[model samples]
Target: MPARSSSRLSPANSRIESMTVAACGGLATPAIETAIRIRLPASSASNTRFIKRSFEAVEPPLTLDEPGRMLMGMIVRPLRVYVSPVFRRIGLMLLAAVVTLASPALPAGGQDAPATPEVAVTDRVAPVWDGTYRRIRVPILMYHYVSPLPENADEYRRELTISPDTFRAHLEYLFFEGFTPISLYDLDEALLTGRELPAKPVVLTFDDGYIDHYTHVFPLLKQYGFTGTFFIITGRVDARDPNYVSWEQVGEMAAAGMDMEPHTKNHVSLQGRDYDFLVYEMLGSIESIKAHTGRQPHLFSYPVGQYDADTLAVARTLPIWRAVTTANGRYHTTDNRLEMPRVRITGGMSAPALASVLRGD
Candidate 1:
């Protein structure tokens, strides 16, 4: 019944009141909203009896808790004989902000447990970056096929392909050894913005858009709660080749949070290509994957691990962030980001052997 306090509120609460007034189409001035808020004690127990009688002709649109309803009751009862319409509108807006920004309520029986706020994945990995470029040693395992070698397969294919059982063994080894799978984006973020990566970060990349990647690799990665980056050859997928993954399968993988990137349009080497040829191969595949998956591919796997100075120059001109190569080594730095190296996983390599390789033994 007394006048609201003339004291100033905290800067945050003042901003909230100002914004709420603006959002309500200026129907209620900041002073009015502030007045009602300053008067309502969160623990006030003037029941909903006053509100029901005051607005019997029209219902309040909000679904308020017991405390909020009580606070409304106290404010509404005083203004019912005066400007009922104006008070009703202003009361609703101020009450919503008060309840939201106020501290959590105690549970029944007055338990002391406060509701925990949900945290985002980015918040966990985001770092207070200092703007210093740094590098780290993280083995980026690369695979072509997770299937058995085809009959009479060439020596080149043998080096590129690893059997399904061997692939599963590699994942099991990594899991047991506490190797956390990360995307190239993760690596790039850490390099540029000082973002924190997992304790044991490792990158798993499957190149060339192979069909086995979707069939064998996808399910196994999901089974282990791991994610891999797949470098797609857009031309092969567009042609619907049985040996390559389809756009539908690519969509499904992208939706599942797998990193889908570009290899090239026709899987050609960019080492000696001209500017037009380079753009068509690199940017073309990038655009294709973006169209199919609704995510622009920032990471690129140079076709056949081939590139030259021209290639790097052109790649820099595009939106591509990091370009991986078949060269051996895991140490990644901002200086050589465009030519990040990978650890090749070949056939006939056991899980322990892969372990030894990753361990740098």
Candidate 2:
């Protein structure tokens, strides 16, 4: 390749480059102001610099596409003058600048960055991000029981239970395909601090504290080295209900690093409940959970995915972080935190069906 031209950087381009550099270098605001005032008058980011140093930077034996693109870049550069972005957006602008600087010349396939070949790995979950989605799609997966159902089980039992074998396959598929399981707290912290989450994040949630959770789900979660959220019905806990788990099991799961959010005091639907009912369901659950687990529950799932507008309003009043609903869609950071949707996993959901769900299809 011939040496790049030594022409001076355009005043506009230079100012932009300087600002990007300054931001990355953690430069003082006064220096940036000095550059804006003295180094770059408002007029300088206009017509004169449009045939900017980018064109000059291009060597002469140009392709038919080069001049057109140069002209396009030059035109867009001036439009930045009219756009006054906030300071927070400056980091994003810096990223764009970095990309531009790093790959000034396109790769052989016309991509700015080299095309990475997909390498198959038996144990790795294949990454799926293509940088095209408008919103981050994370599937908050809901499960109830993960025990082997008998051949003569009832409809509700079958609908609410996933076979342990199928559950393990699901976990295997997730692990092989590279989905990172996270908790509601992780999502909350990310929303608050603008922290980046894994490219493919899937939250495993088991509703209604079942003995099967301690027997099958918890062990499977541990086997896969994954995390999950277990929603407990505080009234059923430690009451010797054969179906529901004990407080010792709940405490063990929490100590083992699983998230334990509240379901309700008695697992009642909150769709049209009064203020007193709502308080008992939400606050009562919190107090009961604290009494048993030594830590107050901070997140919740609506019992049977039932909640109305009034119930949601009451939920907002609770000290809990947020609540989840049974509506079937993926979770995005921008989605309503109070009414987040989840994909329910049930018996005999094939790997392909689960894959489609993960893909937000």
Q: Which prediction has the highest lDDT against the true structure? A: 1
Colliding residue pairs in candidate 2: 124-176, 125-176, 125-177, 125-178, 126-177
**Mind giving the per-residue lDDT tens digits that candidate 1 earns over 1-361?**
1122232222222111111211221111111222222233234453211211111111112233576557646644454332322343345334333432222323224344353222121111332335576878889988888898899999988878888888888899999989999988888888877778999899999999899999999999999999999999877765457999987799899989999888987788888765445655776676556655666567899998998876886676666778899999989876676789899887778998998888891
RMSD of model 2 against the true structure: 23.7
Residue 26 in model 1: lDDT: 15
Clashes of each: 0, 5
lDDT of 2 by residue, 94-116 (tens): 33233222223232233343322
Q: What lDDT does candidate 2 reach at residue 49?
A: 32
TM-score of predicted model 1?
0.64
